[model samples]
Target: MIKTSLVLFFALLGLNLFAQERPTEDPAITYANTITVEDLTRHLTVLADDEMEGRETGQPGQYKAARYLEEIIKGYGLPGVGPEQTYSQPISFISERWQEIDFVINGSSKRHLWDYYAYPSKNADRAKVMTDEVVFLGYGIESEEYDDYGNQKLEGKTILIMDGEPKDRDGVSYVSGTEEASVWSEDISLKLKAARRHGVETVLILDPNFQRNLSSARKISLDSRMHMGFSEKPADNYSNSIYISSETAKTILGSSYGKVVKARKRIEKKGKPKSVSISVDLALTQQKKVKELLGENMLAYVEGSDPVLKDELLIVTAHYDHIGRRGNSIFNGADDNGSGTSTVLEIAQAFTLAKEAGVGPRRSVLFMLVSGEEKGLLGSEFYVNHPLFPLESTIANINVDMVGRVDEKHAADPNYIYVIGSDRLSTSLHEINEAANEKYTQLALDYTYNAEDDPNRYYYRSDHYNFAERGIPAVFYFNGTHADYHQDTDTVDKINFEKMARIGKLVFYTAWELANRDERIKVDVGVKP
Candidate 1:
């Protein structure tokens, strides 16, 4: 019995010593330390060069960028997801460029690109020609208090409506919010969907605001818009939408304009919907040049060491796309995303090096360079919807956008970074980030842009929003907007490489903690800070 007790005590002592001396150094930290400013500059030089042509979505520039990323990741010995044995995740896109538009009201030809403007809708094919009876629905709003189409038969009919919702006598909007317009007024998509639900085949939004300002029409003409959903074709019974001048509405109503205006005022004063029928014929003809294109999101991963935890994933993303070019000017988006992209490359390499050194993290990390982010987060949205890994297994996302330069807010204090959505879904995630920063790359981790009500809406603007929307914890690293943001002046010379490397290291450290932690970060649904 004495000999057995002595053996047990010795074994316990050995176990304690083993626990205390367990390498004392985190290999993930060692890997993160490998990320360097020189490597970041080297990658950025190639990515943001003028020859790359701004890395526009679905364009040659973006394709080249995708291929470059794929080759780099492949070189790092990272394996792709499927049988393709490549890092490219192809996404299909349909591009629409409007050529011409003709809108006629009551046999009187309306001016094109002046009195009314029609954009190439995903709902329209190569051409869309519609001749239908017009109905004037005041504001075209349907609410519990008042229904505009309560007893109205609007099937296959074109409805003309105002831009804003109703207001009380005091001029305060009745829907919600005091300073800004309600959701109904803010989102035209909501109004369009509502109009379609009421069996309205077409909608003409008459706004005095858009009439004089030809900016919207100019933008639509300048850029070819891409859409992912094909069901938007008008031939598929989708609603046709157009924005017209108030003058067009007046011309359509003619002698009944006074009565319509009176009804509008009455509705605004009474805080109710006033639906009216006007005898008018409306005709719309649009011509579009269509092109189908393919885009790709570059995805590469480092597998975890622990067999059980290898299935869990953490994603690091940056959009490698920007507006291609406008005439002679190239909007070289070096700081916009090239910085973030290069940083991702370095972080990925660091992890790869660590894995080769036989000290990989416990959970997997996916390095994604998504395209179509400039085109409304298309690639990220597609990934979330058709994810290679189950979203439930996605532990968190660290998104980097425009982290190279110091913005106006941080010009004096250049070491600061706009950290958004850290506490949005996970309290533990935020704590990990704070601790990582305190220990490693001591960045001024700014949370000013993290607020949901922030005007810039940084949280919703980046690729991380797609992950967050799917209940995954996401944090966006940003350097706020500068004068050169989305402009031709945003070139490589303007990028602050040292500051960028620091931010990159911060992200790597945060990811290191997340990937090496014993358990997944606990999601804090209530804390949105």
Candidate 2:
């Protein structure tokens, strides 16, 4: 009787497996194979033009750009995303104006607004700290294998450390153990978590030029304006941070720890000892606070042609908003992302044109242009937390950041494109990218950010990083950094439209193939950097 029941169960299981293997439908093809550069340039001109005032987030100009994108997409003739009417998914967020801050070192006091800056932190409420004991921890780096503090207690003490992990030109921090170098590329909230884990409270990163040589106070301030609840791990008992000059660190850690600034001769000799102690007394004064600062991310979609594949989705994204009017001079983010958003519009047009021609993609595509990127990838963060589409059905995302300008290395060629993070996650996506590149636009695909030990950490910097963390395959298209990167002079006039078109064409083609391919790009599990 048992044998008979086992045989029956096996037969039923085999029958079910057979049913699962049944072929449903062929691959999807959404476009009519007729997307041109001229159409792309038209959208690029209006979006990247200086008249948009760099399309700063939450500014009137960005709203105009979003409205313009809506109008343009409407003319493309695809079905609306939401049930109501137009193609918009509003992501709610809050903005805080850090109107007041006062910090002092060695009897010298300065306001954070002018002397130091503070980006908003992703915390529940006001995280304040008064006079506290500060400790000088080298790099504040901790590892189970080789603890920098070496069993020394760092609890309830402020830490002074260097900027980044120790490494060569290649990004290999060469330090063994993951604990010491576990710093992530998200907001300052993660840093706070790291501090808490290391048994430290207030942190004073002494490295003046740590992590892109960015100002610590400024980076922290920018991160604070982000939406609440963005972090997987909150800032626990740890809070309050600042940066002091190497000169100031010397005064703080001079006696037992030696001079904060090391001499060149020290490099020739054995490195200094690992641990030091500090006594810190910080009193942060709050002044009159004012206006709230924040931004928004725009979302849209085009459905798939095939019913089964329609369940799956593809994401094409870019950051539309730039730095708002700061002083008399507004930071025009034309090439930074206006070009990216404009290119997305053109891609949408191409997809809609194909759909009208009865060749719409098999898998749906969601077009997203986010804000608060200049303020530290805020718009993308908002979307990840509150997605318009289900993340499970989302297969992949292709993010375009700055593809308008010719890279310094390819200034003369004008036909090259920088590809980052495509092969980092999914081997299948990497194969698809290479195959698409070969079949479509033949621009050079540079992977300067390919090395696992690369210093820039490009994989974690762009909007694509947000998608990748969710296990979705993603690619970041950049023209590589140039003389004007993050500078006010990154004007549209300097952008190589022809080069931009070529890069855009590559993006359009890549998305076209991925949207229509028989099998969706496979996710590579177990791969880690």
Candidate 3:
């Protein structure tokens, strides 16, 4: 009887074992597994090498970087977007240089570097020599209430003006507010634009402050000769803008300088418009060269499997451009963006592999390798303004920048990553990220730089800000600032490849979840300035 009972117990245990089911596998984990450290290092090895020449914007090095990225995505079998089905988006810009500046006021023969300075107009394309009657148009501010050049014959003429708008008796500004001056006074471009709109051939701005800093201004003028401005389409207005000292102004105004100075004081005391006429022959000779530069923003897309959900999109971005070489020392920004650029390529490969294996996300993914990020996020800005895909259908942007090296704050902690702008426009995005990290990567998601008042202003610094400004939720992956940031020392030997891979996997998981979730992540948080 004991043997029979034991046999029956064994039989019941066997039945229970057979009836049990295997646990379901998470797709996010499987897809994220494709991002490997070896792959990231291999790509970074080529991208951050000295041969790339820092990937400067509009330079041959930048074009090589673009080709490398284009070929990379093409290898993944991702197709290009739009009718042309090309992977490159063209961006035309004007690079200006100050070739020459010759000015003679009342035969005094003002010096260039010592007494006066001038720069080629932003829209200047050819050399121009202007000889016109100089008219003192006060501050040259024109608006509904204040018109300094009102009804004045300013067409085909030169205008002399002063810096800063008219202030009240208490030094308060009515154009802006009681405490601060308006955009007219603070922004030089606005002042120049106003002068050009008046059909003025030249604008001589009497800037005492600039004159005091003439030494610094001369250095700045030489450095800024290669200033670039976007010119894909036609733009209006060109004024040969010059900044002169008070002494130069006096020489041009002759005996009328004292009266003009007194009138300026009166306007400051009473907050009134004081437009005067200065009779002087102004002649300027400037040899300007405006070279049109063509830049390309790389784009490639992987189609989603789900019929209905495939319309929604997720974007991954990283800038491949750097500060270029200063002299012979190359600013090889390996960690600044080379790490992020490699991480993006790895993420794209992982997504492409998942799609091929029939475990792809429901939503499409667009990989963008942009240029001109170091120059002020110009590539991403252009993308958002003129997107290949509809901005509305795009749910979020995952931007990676400077994720290779550890900063002072994270030196002691290896398992850390800087998470910015995750909660700025969407609470759901923040929660999803926390859940994904907890489930997969346990790296500490530091929000130190996410504070609205954070001095670094990390949110507005990266390419993600462009999407966030358009109300699309974004997450910026960073390792915080390091000593070698923006320096020539940010080399490939310094990047933590293992840590970079972990962060890349974390991004993959987030994108995977965002792309395949039952519903899109809701924009539930208010955007911060």
Best by TM-score: 3
Task: Report every candidate's CA lDDT.
Answer: 0.82, 0.66, 0.82
Please provide, for model 2 over 416-493, each residue's C-alpha lDDT reduced to its tens digit, 9 standing for 90 to 100.
877888886788787777877787667788888866688988778889888888888999998778887777777767
Q: What TM-score, to 2 decimals, does candidate 1 have?
A: 0.62
TM-score of each: 0.62, 0.58, 0.63
For candidate 3, the TM-score is 0.63
Task: Tell me how many residue pairs clash in candidate 1.
Answer: 2
Residues 1-529 of candidate 3: C-alpha lDDT, one tens digit per residue: 9999999999999877764432127766766777888898999988888988999988888888889988898888888888899988876555555667678875546778777886544435335454636777778788765668767778778888888887777777756647687778877777777777878777789886875678766775576433334642213655667788877887888877787888787767776677667777666777755666567788878888999989999999998889889999998899989999999999998888888878887899998888988878888887888889899999999999988889997788878999999999999889888998999999999999998889999899999999999999999999988789889999999999999999999998888889889899888887666
Q: What RMSD value applies to candidate 1?
A: 13.8
Model 1 score (lDDT): 0.82
Candidate 3 ranges beyond 4 A from true positions? 1-24, 95-293
Predictions ranked by lDDT, top down? 3, 1, 2
CA RMSD of each candidate after superposition: 13.8, 18.0, 12.4
Per-residue error for 316 in candidate 2, Å, reads: 0.3
Across residues 1-529, which tens digit of lDDT does each residue of candidate 1 receive?
9999999999999998996556438665667767888888888999998888999987888988888888888889888886666687887667667667677776778776778776665346435456545677888877665566677888878888888877776667767636456778876766777777877877888877874567867676557766564324554544677788776777877877887888888878777667667777676777777776568889888999989999999999998998989998888899989999999999989888878777777899999999888888988998987888889999999999989999887788898888899999988889999999998778898898887788988788899999988889999999888899999989889889889888988999898889888988877676343
Cα misplacement distance, residue 405 of candidate 3 (Å): 1.4
Q: 1 or 2: which has the higher TM-score?
A: 1
